[model samples]
Target: MTSKPLISVIVAVYNGSKTLQRCIDSVSDQTYPDKELIIIDGGSTDGTVDLLIANNDKITYWQSEPDNGIYNAWNKALNHAKGDWIYFLGSDDYLWKRSVFEETSSHLFKAESENIRLVYGQVARVTKNDDICCIEGDSWDYTRRGIVADGICTFTHQGMFHHRSLFETYGKFDESFRIAGDYELLIRAFKEGGAALFINGLIVAGMQTGGVTANCTKLVKETARARRNNQLRVITIPWLISYAWAICYPSLKSLIGDKNSRYLVNSGKCFVAVLSYKKNAILEHNNN
Candidate 1:
């Protein structure tokens, strides 16, 4: 193997024909010279496979087979990655431009030691319908040049570059979760990982956002279990409020301030709060 491959761009795709070609094009266009793009396809029935086959010459390593879930496919790609650093760029999401590689590499190489395990610049998260979903603001205060001061935002799986050895120290992402596994990893990284770097720049990633609350119930349940399994940050104001915010507004519910609606929402909110604390405590204790 080469001495230090700078970055490993891993992508897990499933029936992604609608966006796979664009995603592949972005990787192919990256300006960085010493990087690898590992693509993992989960037996896509759509023309996704055909498209990938045509683009096979551009890919370093790729596999197409059924996997349990998205995270599982990602795990496979990680194992095959040889880059010194890792970045997970989803198939449905595209980079802001070809300069992403050049820009990201410049900042990442500044870290002389292995202690800096991660870095996240800004990202313009666009919706799948060709609409701007969130237009993030740059911090004007010189003291606040970066949006995320710490790994609190580490839970966000996109718009970041991570050290490859961080996985060896902290371990790869847990494949058991279908959602919010990123959250679980964020907590772990912040709690046990090394120093994190921030660039405070913006790259665009087109994400499908309508299902924000589509899986709230399942997310709540899985989170409840995960919290129990890895209890940390119990009684923290942010954690408590996170629990509250996760279930406070139901998309299917009536308008706010309705008497019965308020009660129901409050009740759900309370349940979330208790579960949050209990699970957080449990997980934290186990880690200790």
Candidate 2:
């Protein structure tokens, strides 16, 4: 006679009216019944508040107020979460399917007894036109190496779920990291003693390509800083390679478009039979 664990979905947004409805609809239509949706708006003036009010019935709790940044908004939302598992859903992103929660519930149920702090799968990176760019995420074996040794983030937060105990133990997102705070928090947990489980073949969300994280230089710099702050060395070869790719990716995407740019990158890597810290799921498909 045990009840299903509750999942608190937190969305932090600003001026996100355009895609917010899609995001809200995706969450509201989920098949899972034991879930709550919480949203924090960064005092947007672009009609985002209106949208929030219209969808108030579906939201467990929502607020429209100025916040420092994404992490700040997320930290604020944490104060109101009352679930065993927490998920951060981007206002510009949506769950890949309505059944995502129902499908992942069994994994989350099992993770409880195993004490796994992170349960993640893959996310589809899409262009503004909604064309899939690539699938992002790797096995924990690959993720652990990137986080622990290379100080790289090999997974997207949109596809990851955090156990409540992780926050109770390591605390919430670091507001200092504007773009890489999510990565920083994960680093703290994994480096200090946290276990993660990766669900293969599960594509949890579709993440739009452009965002604050699209500023490659700032993102890479902040990622490096987070690693340094977490006691990881900053000069690893993988880190250097990531920095180089970050610098080039924007211009490359601009010239060839997002989908083509990713295809080219993966194609080049496949020819060399070499893999970096993060492996693209598309590469395997393209190779075949």
Candidate 3:
């Protein structure tokens, strides 16, 4: 691979008129010259098509059609991409800065020599209330921890830049999973010995509070199912408690008349569960 390989920024949208311009502009404003912006719109009717038409000069390849789900749309994007590295961006998300791709290129080139299939950086989660939370990408150790503990997701997809060969090697995202396909794909890649490099800068700013994964109950259940399907041991208690909290937290707050108290209780439970899992893992390692 070349030192500065072509990067494909793929975005799949469905009626994303409100935020599509922001996403498109972010990619257009990127300082990286050898990049292509490929957008696969799922037959949007909310003025998105007009906006796309107006910006046809900016987009390398774009098509609007009905698709089964986001994964299917992504698969379409992959088919049209001509770049060596692929970065998937959400319609609601944007690149952290104009220099994101420029800053990441050197690390990606080094990782390429080491045969790494993925390079990821940190993402700043922009909540609905405009609160920002930083989520870091995973190292091998962090990935191993996630395999053992079901409560954690090792990385967010928004900040990750994947080699095109990874899809050819491990297959595309499983279209059957409406919510947890990204998680499932990551687990499968790691299990198949696909190495990853974690870069040290912010790549994208993702909106945290919306989308299909926003339903905490569905997310927790799907995540557990993904873990089980990957043959990773699932810790039932933490997930069960999390599900219950998602469902009952509002009622509990109403009864107690204190939101902070409920938040603390939920946070404490999760903290304790993480500690317990870590303790058990350490014990098992020492015994072995």
Candidate 4:
């Protein structure tokens, strides 16, 4: 008898017909065979569904319909993933190397079966123009230190593999957050989910240099929101709300200038140290 693919790959697409072809091709080129690939479309009117249909046989299953939002789309995709391990690759991104699947699965099997919850690899940034910026030595080796710290993010929905139940433990992504939902979901994963490993190779993501995040103003605002999430459980909920309001108080001159910066500066220093060192930071993440 033959064995099945160890990972189930999901590609989430919505009006991504422009780049969906490259994304699908990357997954098909994966050296590891026997994996199932699922594409979930959120009712694209721009021929995205047609592109997915042209290669229908390669996809395990795909459908187009109205949905709540991106995170909700991801939750729906998770339901269709049936492999021993699951990886969610966005339609706008492609895998870096053909060996990515094999490399990620290598770590998955290396850990004790009971200890394997998820495996995340590094990511290469491909720009909006499709220019690739491969950054080596950025793996961060999530398993050893974990990936829940501030300023630390796990990329490559393409290469982040996990056991099916990892999602169950943390629950689904919070739909309330419009911009920081993925960050919130990953925070949930590393904080509450079980064991995980990080591979030291580049996986795949178009790290568009001029993307929304690159714009300094947007980055600053989102950084502040992420900072609030970082402090969510450490302080009382009411206090946290006050702290968040303080951080968001751009209307006041002291908020933007260094006049009232001492509290924030000191708080950020503590956030970095405490976030990186916790043995199982997830337990502390939701205490509030």
- lDDT to native, each model: 0.62, 0.85, 0.76, 0.59
The clash number for model 3 is: 0
Q: How would the candidate models be sorted by TM-score, starting from the highest?
A: 2, 3, 1, 4
Model 3: how far is 156 from its true place, Å?
1.2
Candidate 4 Cα errors over 4 Å, as ranges: 1-5, 112-114, 134-156, 192-195, 202-288
Candidate 2: tens digits of C-alpha lDDT, residues 1-288: 033789999999999999999999999999999999999999999999999999999999999989999999999999999989999999999999999999988899889878787899999988889998788776786777676676556768999999888899999889988999998888888885567888999999999988998787788799889988988888877677777777788799889988888666544433222254335445666898
Shift in Å, residue 185, candidate 1? 2.1
Per-residue C-alpha lDDT of model 4 across residues 1-288, encoded as one tens digit per residue = 123336787776778888889888888888889688888888999999889889887889888998776677777878887777777776777777787776666566664354667666665555566554444223333322323433433243445676777677777767665444666666666654455566664454443333223333343354346547755333333223334544554443244543333234324433443445553456667674
Per lDDT, what order, best first?
Answer: 2, 3, 1, 4
Q: What lDDT tens digits, residue by residue, belong to model 1 across residues 185-276?
A: 65556543346666675563444443322355555555554555575433344344444544654642435523334345434443444454
Q: Which portions of model 2 miss their true places by more than 4 Å?
A: 1-3, 263-288
Q: Root-mean-square deviation of each candidate, in angstroms?
A: 8.1, 5.2, 3.7, 8.2
The clash count for each model shown is: 6, 0, 0, 5
Q: Model 4 — TM-score against the truth?
A: 0.69
What's the lDDT of the predicted structure labeled candidate 4?
0.59
Model 1 accuracy (lDDT, Cα): 0.62
The candidate that wins on lDDT is 2
Per-prediction TM-score to the true structure, in the order listed? 0.74, 0.91, 0.85, 0.69
Residue 185, model 3: Cα distance from true site in angstroms: 0.7
